[model samples]
Target chain A: MEQTLRRRQPGETVFGYALLLLGLFVMAEGYRIDGLYSPSSAGVFPALAGLVMTVSALAIIRRIHRMRPAHIPEGSGTAREFVRRTTPADVAVMAALMLAYMLALEPVGFLGASFAFLFLSIFYLHRGGLLTALLVSTGSLAAIWVVFRVLFTVVLPSGWLFR
Target chain B: MSDSLSYFLMAWTDPQLLLLTAAGTFAGIYIGAIPGLSVTMAASILISFTFSWDVNPALALIAGVFMGGVYGGSRSAILLNIPGAPAAIATALDGFPLAKRGEAGVAIGLTTVCSFLGGFVGIAALAIAAPAISEFALLFAPRDYLLLAVMGLLLVGSLSGESLAKGLYAGALGVALGMVGMDPMTAEGRFTFGTVQLLGGIPYVAAMIGFFGVSEALAQLHNLKAPRIKQDVSRILPSWSLLRRYLPLSLRSSAIGVVIGALPGTGGDIAALMAYDQAKRTVKNPSRPFGEGAYEGVVAPESANNAAVGGAYIPMLTLGIPGDAVTAVIIGALFIHGLKPGPMLMIETPHLFWFTVGNLTLANIFMLVFGLSGIRFFAKVVETPPGILIPLILILSVVGTYAIQNSVVDVYWMLGFGLFGYFLRIYGFQVGPVVLGMILGPLMDTSYRRAMISAGDDPVAFAQEFVTSPLSLVLALAVALLVISQTPLWRGIRARLAGG
Candidate 1:
């Protein structure tokens, strides 16, 4: 079988450049840790690692530059295509829910935050209506609470508001 | 000999130990088969709970989990395209294709048998080769360790993903992430950025859950509407002829698993990947083309990964060096139980060594029984709609992260890494190297520093050591060849050589 080349993703160039910037920033931080006065210094490995990352990012950028431009879907611009491909509605919404759940964990507690996150995500994604989402989320939450809290005895965050 | 024999049979004779082993194996399978749950997470959590227990029972339970978890990864790899663990990444190359072809039953059956045989090979090797290999392992100097870590990163980087460059970047990024804490030797902060939370460094378990678990859940969103594949369950057990046909290959792969697993800073993921690569090269006739539902493809990785469990114990039990992340946790448990685990422990507590060998053997047997019996039920997991499954996976990821330290900060880190990993995946980058790099980075950093210090901080001396020391030279050469093999020049040469 013949090897097939990878098709370019729409925003791959931007992502590659972002990585390059991150690599350079890491190199700067590595240098700031400790100068090259001693080989045994902790900064040396981090610096080396950063250097490798920078070089690899450059190489990747070059490869991405050489690839054929990604094909935009019909009647859509490149930005739209990139958005649709990388972060579609479902992913964006789910990610938002996750962020919200994480933020709410301390204030709302594990039980409240988890229930809301699970119920809302299931309802939106599954589109099976409210009762199905409610039942599934409640059941899963109960199981998780029993296993992790009651059995494992993990000290989950209790809401300050509740207290 | 009789004493050793009786100690070896300890778990088998004790009722509580027997039950624990069986339960641990059963739980390990589900834990490993679940998308967000991992053997490392389970082992670490179990450590916290079981630290107060007697060493024998705790060891038995952990051993069972380790054995079963390694094999369990292949189940998800075959049934769904998502690998349950990094080791199963290679299994999914062909296993998922087989599942798509309605041969999920046959694939699972073949994988189960091969894994059992492989587990036996690893256990037998552990029993026979532990002392000898530990002696060999002791010769690995800091520089040699640095070389081994480099070789591992390079190996994983090249094995997957769209290009070598992307893989290298990911690996380096991981190393950088691992650097985000106080320097071990100097106690000076490296990348703490004046933050108290950053002083402890990023929780790698959180990184692991994010990259492997949350990222996968997000990726599955693309296929939420896609219907699940209908599996044929008529043939759950492989024919005797089929087992006989693959026996030699399974044994060969198991040997590969054992060696890689025995090597410190390496584990089943690398072993399975290498075995898959070896099978791709050696097998003249496969059930089908590799990456297109080949039976040999599934068999090779399944055998190698399970064998790695046994291989992983050798260094942990005999040398005090963990064979893998799970073994590292097991080592901590050993310490908690007031036992040291280095070479002296093998001599001082010979019965412990014997008991472990016996316990691992029992776990292997339990793995096979538990692995095969639950297939019909487990296979149904893949049929679960992505809509519901994705949310549950995310919750598990969050809980797994929180359970590590009860810190909300880790949950945030996990989500951040998950988003970043999702972006990487979309752009055709492999996240495996990143995880491996994170795991190996601190080890590599310390080794590099120690080697440099030993070389008196002279670059020329450090360079010279690579070629002068026999072990260093071999590993250095291996790293050189691996790097060269990934270049375009090497690929061109290979194609020309093949054509000629």
Candidate 2:
């Protein structure tokens, strides 16, 4: 069936190899636990799952290899390029900002850190100017604070700075 | 019959209790609509406040929220393509397409009525056949449950889109990921890497938000400047004719929902997915193809999830076992209120059962009212520029992740999964199976091991037991059929047989 189909895409092969690596890692790690030698052992399931993954991924690689073109197309880096192109700069920035917010959450406090992050993120995404971002951020954070703290009784991070 | 009718009206009799149910249902709709804010999170939080309250009112509020939450999930799924809850994952498959085609209003309207009808069927099943269903549910052995989970994984065959191999790989990866936390049976960590935070396991909700919400948000960035589709909110409620047309399908899906939901360790998510698959195969003339904005797709999951609510209550109320995550939390509330949740509690406190049924029924009614009326506003949500909405969604995802256990670790996990999911989506790997693996992974693992242990760790004995027990044999056959039916060989043979 695979032979009849077109060759796997550039990214597809990379993903297969990545899965192969992950399966190997999982299998290696499964043995670290005690009592995995037996079928009922703690490590058996993970190891078995890992083995299945390893085999499946190997199948993918073999299929890709068999289906590879004779010329062996020069620049096999298109997959990397696709990944790079797909995650545009704005998304990369937004993702980075989110990571920053999470890191700052406990230290800067929920309200303060959230307000700053929300304002910056909104402004960055909208590019609709900083003023609109400020109002929206403040209002949205206040609503969140009220909903979690007042309505649901979930305590937002108070922050070491606040305390 | 007279006694049952009176029990049904119990919640309506008391103004305070009725108000609580109504308010909880009203609040649940909005909470469930938010992409990252899950109903389980909301219900669990509600318990902190409701623990001290009387049992009657507390259960009433929770019941209302549970029913409303299930229906509310589809709201965001249809409008935004990001399912608010796991149960709505299948809903988004067809629903978002409908929204793109400017039928968001009709989609929401049709689903709301279907969900209400599904809720009714579930409640009716609960009311009329509680004991029998609960007993039947108890017949499931660990091996049987494992087969059921396998049956669930078969959904990837339908959900996989164009590549069965990709789906298998993705689903297998999800199962592997689910195995990361501490092994429940042996108290040994599998993939924690000597980290304390990893011991508790990656939070499934965080992964869900990452997979569906953040991934989609990133994908949407590609078309940021595309004109937002205008939703047609002209018809906010289903026409009588439309309802009549879908009534049979809704009822059938609801029955599927109740059975799956009644089983311990399974709930609305599996029920919804299975129902969607069933509709895909059974419905000969869907208004559209199953995945590309089919009304039948929306109807199957929406109805099934709602019906699963009543089904979930069956095990929790009758057998003392929580049917799903929300019910499990509600069980904690019941214990906190100094009431036991097992069979003795039911025998001793029968009123509790009837009152919950009443509460759920009322909440279903409120769900229909709020769900239908709120379409115009939710439809408008899609009209917001992607620039603003995407950022808002991310922020909400952050807050929602953080709210679960108040741990920044979960937020980080959400982000990681979100990035991974984005890559997967671009490469044509559906992210849904991964979440399914995460959700069902632990259950599958524990059941398989327990069944193995029960068989004295002998594979032959385990296989023998499956064949010996009628129930197990039936489920094993279903699993085998599910596996065989997905093969190209099977498809070829089927095609040839039909041709001949």
Candidate 3:
């Protein structure tokens, strides 16, 4: 049987450059303000940080440019396989879940929103039968609720539904 | 001595306190046994529950949890390849290999005993060294703290994944993240970007949960289809001869743990890894090399991390500065209960110091009892589907984050970090340096700026002062040597010198 070869993709290099560009932009924004105690003064550290990041990114880019791409394992044939090795789909799912969480947190109340978020996230990750997901999510939510609400006496968002 | 004995007796007589200690121990083991949950998180959560309680009970509960959580992480690291916390990363190297060979029970049992021994030694050191160390710590000016922070940042070279430069970048990024909240000196907003939530700055706990907890869950999803783990749970205890053999190594590791723990900003995770590395170097005879089911590997790390709990308290009780994030939260508890920690704390509140010592001793004993009893049940949790566990962790992370201030903003920040952290991990970036950077950044920044001001903006004066101080000079030389050892030219020269 013939083995398929794998190589580092250009897209990965592009992604690195994109991060560097974003960091540079942020650094530029940070430098725009000048005041000792002004509201705008917070930008100084971020600006300095962004500059550092940009330099590091450039170094990484140079290093990557000089390096030979890695060979794919035998029996795996195709660019798709190589991409799978590098980029995990879960990253996208996790990103989406976080976005949903941020958007829904205020509207849904801490308890209701967190419970739903937990359920969906578990389902996505576990891909288990509904019963298992429900049992786990419900148990986790109840434990959290008891700790925060009953024990700590901290007020969580009630949302319009609870109110 | 008599006053300390009475405090110890009072702690022993109080059954409720004993029970809390026991519960905290059991809970900490389970928390540590689970991959992704950390002792620090467990302690942080316990703080909220104990917030309104009296200082003694609150300290007892947090102390119990702290001891338990540190030992608990080794459980998962041994039984499964997954490390329950960063402290257990070194443990997992040898621990998982032993489990794969069907000696999971023995590995765990030995870890439990070593953890107990380590905790005791750490407390013993703390009880003896804290007064003297606190006195020394009192002499530390802002300039000294700045130097300490720089020394810590140097660890980036060791911790960075594959590339040292990358690690420095990650660490610098973390320090910047730490800079996001309110500026300490000016009380001015530096990075809030005009948002009310930004005024308070980023919460460390949220970033921690996202970085360690949420990021691990995301990574686990990639390998969800791996085969379920199976093991016999009957042979949990190590033979007497096995215990006798590793006793010296455990003691040495515990000493390392205490020393590392005493250093401000350093914690158990670093201590454990360094101890493990040192053990590999020092111990000549082994049934096998480390990371291949070596008993010394497990014993060294388990002992060191547990001992770190005692080491951490030395600074907390002596100086006002917290040794780690969990201790920082405990500092908040202390302040709320009308107690302040610092040099004068010993003079003003001797009983408080004794109470802490008593509490730590009790927490360690409870950890021993609880750690040995529940091997079978926790092993079963490994079989629980990731779908269930991951979501459950997320829920806890959210509730835990929100409970900090009951603010939805923290939850948002946590989720954002969680997403960012997941991507960072996928691209071979390490998350540990970032957390270390965030925690230590402000300390570095404030102290450096303050040191400059104190020196009248004269760089030469600052240099002269550091050189004149015996301790600072030693520390400066150590930093210089550490930097030199990392350079390619230094390596070549050292190799040549050795050859000659």
Candidate 4:
């Protein structure tokens, strides 16, 4: 059995819809403030921007459909295919870890939160070296704390734990 | 004349001042080479530390940092594909590709020398033609400024990666984002959605770091184990023949830099992009095609941005208006020193003007010395393992974003844009236009509205003003040419003309 090489681009449909929704929302927001009747009104520029965005998004959708038949296979699990193609598992994990770091930041303090985040990230990426991760994370956080707090006099968040 | 001569040579004679200037320039180059650390940030930080010192020493250090930082931004741009500051955005376009091909050292060396040459041109203008240039800058009307902003946005056509439509959408999106916050004209909220923090709008600095720094970090996670490129450090200094060849282009870009930098609300970023665009249109046979490691691409932006340092001072010393953020900080320093910066400044404190020119001259010389010597070391720095470098970049992005206003919310915005920008990059959209839009969007909006209001709500009157005013008409014609140059018809005509 011979398999043909198929050229496919990812996320056009998703991107187009996202942009369309954003354009409509922005347009509605513009109207809610000031009606678009007056060109010099506060809403005029934003409304025009929304209109351009919406039109461009429609064009993107049209372009995607025009190009899709030759590339993306028409079959089951298409959404899964897009997910796999667009967001590989490694990237998703890193992104999730970043979000987690942000959330834990204020509560855990700069040093506390940053150290943990750094260590976990480095260790995971380095494939689990306990001592190196421990040393690397601590040293990096210390350098930052000294530079920002002691030298520059910036008051970084102490968080509940450290202060 | 002799008093002015004494002022010009003062820094060279004073040991403390010369030492401070040299130290400041050296630190600035390193700080500027680091991702997420900008010249503006360093200048602002120095203001606090140097507050108690005498004004002359403070000014010398800040001036050195200013010159060094502007040139330093290109180091990271060439080596890492991450712009150290907004002004270096254009530098990274072709600089990164050159680095990937192991030509990073030559790129760095060429940009450094061009930057020095450009700096000299800017200083020459600052010294000789400052008064006349400032008077000319004052002649620009609101409509003219609007045309300039539009002209900048027009470059999105060239910078847009694969699709013009995608670029337009991104640019419009950026414009809309910039429109958020209270309308400066009235107290009316435009896109605030009742948020108090957003009353000031999204910080473009944070947006810059996220799009270029954090987003690039996220993108790097895909090939975390990919082999790093080894930069060639053998030919670090550019040859005299290469310098001789591009001398005309360098001088033209420096002039453009000075003019744009002297304009209020414009800065090195705009000048760099404009110069890069000009090079693209004019250089019929480039060493390489642009966005693919063209030497002209690196030279045009690096030279323009550094020259902008001197150009920025032109307005501050003459008109009391700041040319850029760093210059604005300098204005504050001047105020602290009990000197007012304006037209009166040139006459009343001629010594200050001459002193600044001399100081910048010394800084530019130091910039050349420091910029050329560290190429091999800089190349080795960029070869850090991705596993180490990527996380380091993300941390620096967060820290830099937070440092802007000490606002955690800004960090969140950086992360948000980082994720969004990562997706955009994956989809073949260049992140440059988005940042370009964010930077230029507010300028465009405010200028357009002001120009409209000046016309008393008369659309025809407002439109006519573009053709009626000589300066506006010139800008209008430039904008028209920019549009025509982007069209297929113009390309076809040019091709046919060349064939004939």
Candidate 5:
């Protein structure tokens, strides 16, 4: 059967170009490590991988160029549509919350950080009210604590603040 | 022989092991049936939780999970038309149609029985074939190992994602990531840039959790509002006549599953697809038109994918090469337990082999019991909105990452990779090759270095050895053929041949 070409996703071209740059940087790093001293040099395999990456990235760009652009809905700019389609408000908020949770894991500890992140994110995503989110998050946190900390004996961070 | 039998029955006879196996299988079913939650993600996370336990218990739980997870994917596929895992993508084709026709119960029952049968075939193959393969694998040289790794990566890249280039890019990127930290051979930092943390290399478990777990959760955001479809299921147990009728097709699909699953880098997803395709072509008269709702359609994929569970283990146990993504993660678990997977693994720890075989057999039994009994509960479970599930998964990802060595740095790595992996997914790139590449990268590097050193660092001599030795020649040819087949020239030639 003939393969169908899917409409190119928004930001695909830019992503391809970014990957290409990464490949080039890696290639340069590979060269910096060892200047093609020998086939068995520490840098050789990495260099080969970088070269493959570079070549593939260029191929990806070429393929992307052949595809038609995505159809933006009426009354929406392409850039705005791209962001909305790829990373909607909920996703963006969740991502930001994830970043906060990770940063707070040490200072705020697993329990505090996780509870807050879970409750807030669930409340935001679920939109079913705050009390339910609080109950769910708390129950979940307790279950996780019991499972990992108590039963499995994993040493979760106690937080310097708590100490 | 008697000792092997004893080991094979170990899980069945032991109470703790039996309970763990049953529990793992039960959990695995739910995991596999839930959309956005995958066997690979669950297995990777489970490894961290189980890391400190005895190797036997750890293996038992993981084995159950592996067996159950493969079969469980069909549950959601049948009920919701959303494949719980990639392996059940084909199952959803006819499974959902059957559900729509109010034969959801019958469909699930047939799928459960066939999956059980296929699981048996796979285990039987593993029991019979792995030791023999391990013996042969013992004769492999470093060059041959390199060729095998290359072949695996090439197959994974070409078979998955939108384009070969994208696959290759993801794979090479993984190889590059694997090269980070200290050079295993010389203890010199390769990509550290003088950073003390970089010297330890990126923790692979972190990478696995991020790429598979976090990235998947982020991707699920796209379909957060997709309405859940409800189906009433009744009478899940298939009649004996129904079983006898589909037995031949299930067996045939199971055979296909074993061969495809045993191939390194490929897994149940591909096996199920091929089996479904094969069934479409071969089965002369179906209960219905191939797509409209055929019993064979559901039977082929479910059976094949479950059978693939056994097929996937053969390479990981015998050659230290993963048959697919889950096995790749399992390899990490094996390493953590101080067990080396390869030919020596079989020779040194023969009991582990038999115990696994037995455990998988037991898991299959549990899969059958759980799969048939819990249709109503499973329907409700699949309806659990991604809104709640995603947060839970994120929390699990964090805990799973932290559990591995309790390193905050690894958690950061997980987050970073997760975000990057999400973008990669959006761009139509598969993250499977990236993880597979990471696992195989160091193996390829060390193998290449060893092969080169043996040839006195002469590129020509190293190249010459590929063809001079019989084993290496076969592997070299296989690799070359794999690469060539992905090229435009090969496609053009094949098209010409087909047209004429």
Candidate 6:
């Protein structure tokens, strides 16, 4: 079934239509703008660009429709495969980790937040391994900190906790 | 020459400068070796830290990162087929193949030497040719610049996968996307959708991070199984015979690197690819076609990309126009330090120029040392499970984005683009053109419009002026040929002509 799609023409057709719609939308926006050569006008380039886009879209549609059929599929199923392969669980975990890091950034400061972020990330990467994650996290943070703050004399963000 | 020698002597004698060079090289290498961490990011991050420091040390640090980072990207390209930066894209073509054949040590060693040689060539070019190049660069009117940009856009045909039409579409789309944000000629927003934050336009760095870094991470997550690479602990030196054989090719590639690097917006990545393509076209009795472990393939790109660093600085120092994004940020750093880069920069700040030249040379030497010593450690990274690496990459992306301006909005933008990039990649859209578009778009737009206005809105007059100017004519022809060659009809005609 996947192989069949690779030989089919639907993908290009879909892409062509998408481009057409986008071009139309841009053209509408371009028309709504003021004069082309005016100092504060926005229409000139957009109108030109929209016309080009629309022509290209029409060309693509014609080209795809006229092409000879091959033995292979038209679509690679790459999009579907990618969506299927990316587990919701993995995304959720990563999102949760990022959220935690953002929340912790100001309160924990650069060092603490970075340290925690590094640890959790490393831990997640290492699959919740405590000792290995701790070692890697501590080493990475210490190195970054010493290099940026001490050697380079960089003023990293310090929170109230550190003060 | 005497003055340059004296400057070199000063650099040699300054232990503090030497230490800074070493540190910068180290940082650049580490940051560059990581898949998502670009040299631009490393340099930008260093800016806030170096904002208060003296100009010389700050320059020394940034130069080290620039040199080291350019060289560092090859590590992953060789070991994992995943280029650490855009500059390393060509390196992966042959570098990974060599690694697969258990010649990783030799490949790395060859690249290291080539990188150093490339750097030396670039610095030499910068030192000798900057004034002359700057004079030439000034001749590039808006029409010429527009043509040059079109030529760059044409490269999408070569870079895009398989389909020429699809590539052009993507390239056009990229250019259209670039037209977003506030128009340069007029203060009105073109595609900002009436947003205040977007009034300043989409940040190129953030877009790059999203397109390359985050999208790559998302892709890597799909393939969690780490391949067991055979570690061949061999002598980490290319044979003298091998070096002699490839010396001419390396020199040619380095020359290409320097020239492309000098061109604004086109940097190490394009140089590397062009060099690789040239080498493949010319080399006889190759071990294999590229992407099959050819040593020359690795050498050409590695040398060229490293050399491009020197090429990029010429315009930056001579005209105050950055050759690439990294240099743009460096220009900001220079301005912050009360140093303006322009025609009289050499006369006003000759010492600073000399110091930079010296620093670049030293950075190349340091790249050789760090590159060889850290291979074992970096190879270990490729061995890590993708599941682990992917999450860590995300964290780095988030932190790096936020750290840029300390703005949450940037992070949100990054994530939005990241998801968009991931989808695009899945649907077979190439990101390189997008990046190229983002970087070159505004320049093309501003320059063309300004040129038009300067030409009194007379299209015929603009054409006449453009054709009459030798430089503009050359660039115009090149752009025309480049665009035409990519069209299917032109390609078919060319093929038919060859057959005839």
What stretches of model 2 exceed 4 Å from their correct place? A1-10, A59-80, A161-163, B1-4
Q: Which lDDT values do the candidates have, in the order given?
A: 0.87, 0.84, 0.74, 0.84, 0.84, 0.74
Per-residue error for B95 in candidate 4, Å, reads 0.2
Pairs of residues at least 3 apart in sequence or in different chains that clash in candidate 1: none
Could you say which candidate leads in DockQ?
Answer: 1
Model 1, DockQ value? 0.70
i-RMS, every candidate?
1.7, 2.0, 5.8, 4.1, 2.2, 4.9
Query: On a 0 to 1 DockQ scale, where is model 6?
Result: 0.25
Best by lDDT: 1
Per-residue CA lDDT of model 4 for A76-96, tens digit only, reads: 366776777668776787788
Error of 3 at B101 (Å): 7.4
Tens-digit per-residue lDDT, B197-264, candidate 2: 78888788899889888899888888877999999999888788888899999999999999999998
Q: List the residue pairs that clash in candidate 4.
A: none
Model 4 CA deviation exceeding 4 Å by range: A1-8, A36-38, A68-76, B489-500
When 1 and 5 are scored with TM-score, the better candidate is: 1
Give per-candidate clash totals. Answer: 0, 0, 4, 0, 0, 11
Error of 2 at A59 (Å): 4.4
Identify the runs in model 3 with alpha carbons over 4 angstroms from their true place.
A1-10, A22-55, A70-91, A110-128, A151-154, B28-55, B73-110, B231-234, B238-246, B263-302, B315-351, B464-466, B490-500
True contacts kept of each: 0.81, 0.55, 0.51, 0.54, 0.67, 0.19
lDDT tens per residue, model 6, B1-500? 78867776555578888898899999898777766567887788789788999888888889999999999889878876657777887787788888878788888989988998899999999989987766766777777777766666566445434455555555555666777777766677877788887777776666766776677777665555556566564667778998888889899999999988887777898788778867876797787766688998899999999989999999999888897778988999999999899877888878878878888888889888888786777666656666556655665676556656667677677776777676556555566666666666676777777777787777777678878888888877876766676676786786788899
Task: Please write out the lDDT profile of model 4 over residues B74-127, one tens digit for every residue.
Answer: 999988889888788899999999999999988999999999998998998999
TM-score of 1: 0.94
Of candidate 4 chain B, the 10-residue stretch with the lowest lDDT total is: B156-165
For B397-472, candidate 5 gives per-residue lDDT tens digits of: 8887787678888888988898999999888887767876887789899999999999999999999999899989
